[model samples]
Target: MPELGGPTSAPALLRPHDPAPPLLDAARLGVAAHRGLDVEALLTWTTDTADLLPLPGTGSTAALWSALASVAAADVGAARVLEPHLDALAVLAQAPTPVDLGAVGAGGSSTWGVFAAEGPGVRLEAHEVDGGWRLTGTKPWCSLAGTLSHALVTAWVSDDERRLFAVGLRADDVLPAAGPWVSRGLAQVVSAPVTFDDAPAVPVGPPGWYLRRPGFAWGGIGVAACWWGGAVGLARALWDALGAREADQLALAHLGAVDVALTAARACLVEAADQVDAGIDGKPSAVLARRVRTVVAGAVEEVQRRCAHALGPGPLTADEAFARRVADLGVYVRQHHAERDEAALGRDLLAAGVAPW
Candidate 1:
């Protein structure tokens, strides 16, 4: 990892057993058989790895976000590792508590165990119960379900309203549906639907919390890092192809342009993180989040196109790692904020005389 200058100049910690590999490689395998047992281990491993260090007196916002991106690229299988660590992250970002710098870093496996990837393929509804909340419904596309300790799921509070709640999953909270995930890419991701027949859950925050605050924007930005990492993987693959003389001049030019796009996208991401750390409120964060997503999405698309063109039909063969990356990139890029919504935000920023710093 590159040394980033700040008040907190300590080296980022990684686990002793942490093998520094690409994000996809780390996330390749699905969750361990005993997710509960392994979640803490992964977290410990991440902290030991020294990747997630606190930024001195302020928040670990930038470090955590960067760690998420690194983990996403390292292992799409384990990409959701940070979900369980959200509570700790929120605490670290919001409070002035002295962060255990020796604790889990972003790429450590502990953070990945929070999300479970099974569901009933329907949106769930949450009801305020006597003690807490009862979640009854179905949720599709719960990635990493089999191994996650809990899932930070978004569910409607009740019918006919837009209220959303972030619920944590437990053993009895969710059950997997039949059939496996048949997606073209990220097949090992364990993304499936889950059913909650009056499952009990604890709400992370108040109603409408998912949509409000910097968490939502930050979540989007965090996911965007995964896409950006995928782009990096694709670009590297393209570079390898060029080295092998498999790419033509046009393909090479396109790859160069992709490099430019990735650089620009990364700059925007860091800038957004800085702004977020500085406590620049409201629309600025939203706009920066949108920009990071848009730039990354575009970069991934360009790399996919260039890689496909350069590598020819052989690269698409299922056995090839590059082919798998393309599929993963496609799935990851779809998580970006909508283009129209981002554009409208940009327009609002411009109308408000927001100047780039």
Candidate 2:
């Protein structure tokens, strides 16, 4: 596994460490700040590596997904901090081979982590500006606000065409608003609401670019990897903590179970990545993507819950890693696709009387 902050020849930024842990208390606000900075650095590193971009004929999507999953599992706030990079990823996929990770990171890494398009609380809109584009709206769940450099936001072009854009975090372009993301769980994400009063933006590609491509499916797989990583991390933490305790048997059993679950999830991720690389487009790939998401989500939840119980309450309360893993798992598992949608896909496959393999 790649170390979080190892030295590299890439033009990415590096985060310095702080003595305090972000979640300790109000006095540890500095820790949160430091964490946010670290997250930005990590995002830069990710965006700098062309391997992180999905390319034609490159069977590397699974690897990238796994890496992103590890980061999200370790720190969801950091994952959020990298949202702009994710957007730039979509653009990178359309660009030439040997992708310019530095350009992608520099273009969008900052604002992407702080912008949102889902849920009823956030609204985003964009219009063509002189040379770039103008974004006007508010986004809820803007994670890593104080740290992110730009946001890749989605907005309507005349209320019909949905376009994606990269917007810089200029003082004149964005307005900060109070947010409701104060849950004790996933608190490190620090998602807040952002209001855009005619914010300036830059169009990434043609209209309906994101929704019309396989990039969305690929993005979903990346997120699934993150949740899977979190689950694996939680399981590892629990197993290590209780390996020598009286509940050793239970811990062993849980560890075995978690390993199986994670392995299965990884298999699915690899398969999905292969299919994507092979240009297996449309509903079949979409169905497989959904299945991957569902399986990963279920496996991670099971691992987190069981591992937490196996470790007992003492470790849960005192171990920052364990506690954060649990909280991160809780927040990530909710991104599961609707059961009915997944089941409908299964039903269609079954009715076809053909092996989906």
Candidate 3:
């Protein structure tokens, strides 16, 4: 909602409907459902509201990020589930081969997730059969594997090359394994391994294209937007609590610190979205994504720490939503890859010979 560009700039296109309403309303409705770890309710909400979200880098990039952030603010777990689905759609949209979006759950009848993570001793290999691809072996970190009807997954074409493919989860050969997920945060959304036994797939993009695409970096930054939103939610809780009582200087100072961290992170996100639309700087998108993710991740950590220090044990112990939020965000932001990402960014900059201001 804040200025995505300069003072004189207007939104390239007006978002058809505000992304916050459906997510916030779902958050309120899902509070009770969360206790039961109701996965269906979340899926229903995702399918019903999927159309409201816009594709990233499509001039209205800020709106898309705003929607992702709103979802995180409302419910981190919901954001966890929904973000990948949206990312998958965007991935398909960006693919060189034209895809029938409706075939991949864009019709509001099904849900989707992205399963691209590869693990040690496990590989999902894609073999060309009858001029088509069939994914075999296991894929790790397939979130919502049991519930989602489709996924945009990555499988190795050769020893070192991997390509993205769209596969239907409802197919007879797709097997979603049970157990191994026991985190308190995102308790409802289980991310376990899934094995594909000669499962038919449609290649979304050519080998090496998935990670090389600019949208890959944009998707990573979009996750950071969720981190920013999660921080916002925590900061809001701290503010509300402080307002109810005469707060001491320490508590108020923590709030101030929170505001500072969030503002800077938000500014970075806005600028990144603007760059994406305005034809991003000559620098690689990986560089931009790393910078934004690092900033937002720091903000998330700061806000969580400040909120805890300012409010003490009261909210963590008595406020269910607050406690769940804290836990969910703690788990969710780990996607940033912390020190390794920072180091990669440093290495990239050094190689590029970019001067740091």
Candidate 4:
């Protein structure tokens, strides 16, 4: 991960001994960012390096999150595309009967997205068809569905159950909705609803296993790591501006505050990664994930506000790259669910009475 200041720079997110640190190239990502949302180039890059990202809970989870943060620091939009593809690979790898990437996509360059978000009145159902399964109806929140080769989708398998299935996005019947996505941030990512008209599918795990798996919680933490990285990018902008000229007292104060927030967020992530590798104290993974995400999200919010205030209107108005980074981070950090997630964590903590001091 990138640092903010001299000597007292933020702690390295990846350990010095981690072998996977060299696989991520900031220069390559910076070049890719100049392409402006070319899905093919980005997806191809993701495919080539998909296996290099460390799987969560595999004892090298810090390296995984660190790599994610590195990608976001280079370009949040690129991270937007890369994280899910890496996540989809991890999900398949953790499946009870793991699916083979080669079997799913030709030439080993398949890009995948996870389509698990559900919306009101939107129903995607899986049914037994000719000794196999098929999906029907619409699956909302299918990001990059139009461009990806495959996706791990969650759909209703019965009246009361939903299971995850790996489906080819290029299947004839799969329809990725167009338009209605007008967000300035993440303009490169097209997160529209995808309708499956009897699309063929293969189940990744048994009913409810997707959520029950430990990796599910770890995946959520990985996303928080990316949020932390995005915040780091904003902090770097402020740091660079301050170094360019004689800075005022107020701007210096903002930089100090940003450092404090990022320090706490990084510590939370490091501790959570350690716990995940140690089997999470035999507790539900959600507890650990929620705690880390809440802390990181709060830190990200603070960094955004402080960077904006310190930099004033200059970066947002004149610097295109800085403007996009701010916008992309703004949209990406919302994955944390704000107060709703906080409420859920509080209820769980109260119910468990763990006395986490």
Write down the RMSD of all candidates, one decimal each. 8.0, 8.2, 4.9, 2.6
- lDDT: which candidate is best? 4
Residue 20's lDDT within candidate 4 is 54
Q: Which ten residues in a row have the lowest lDDT in candidate 1?
A: 3-12
Q: How high a TM-score does candidate 4 get?
A: 0.94
* Residue range 14-87, candidate 1, lDDT tens digits: 22333333221233222211131244555444444334344311444555555555544444433444433553
Sliding window of 10 residues with minimal summed lDDT for model 4: 1-10
Give residue 345's lDDT in candidate 1 (0 to 100).
Answer: 65
Query: Sorted by TM-score, highest first, which candidate order results?
Result: 4, 3, 2, 1
Q: Which ranges of candidate 4 are over 4 A from the true structure?
A: 5-11, 16-20, 100-107, 281-283
User: Best by TM-score, which number?
Assistant: 4
Task: Work out the TM-score per prediction.
Answer: 0.70, 0.75, 0.89, 0.94
Q: Tens digits of per-residue lDDT for model 3 on 1-357?
A: 322221112221224352333333444335423532567877777766667667888876787787667666666777787788889888878898886545433445758899989799898999999877788999999888988999989999998999988888987899998759999888878899999999888888779999888799899988999888777778778877888899988987998898888888888988888888875633567789899999999999999999888888998999998899899999999988999989999998998886656
Residues 11-96, candidate 2: write the lDDT tens digits.
Answer: 11111221212122332222322363365455455454333344422555554564455455445555444434664555545632
Model 2 residue runs over 4 Å out of place are 1-57, 72-87, 95-111, 114-116, 129-132, 246-249, 337-357
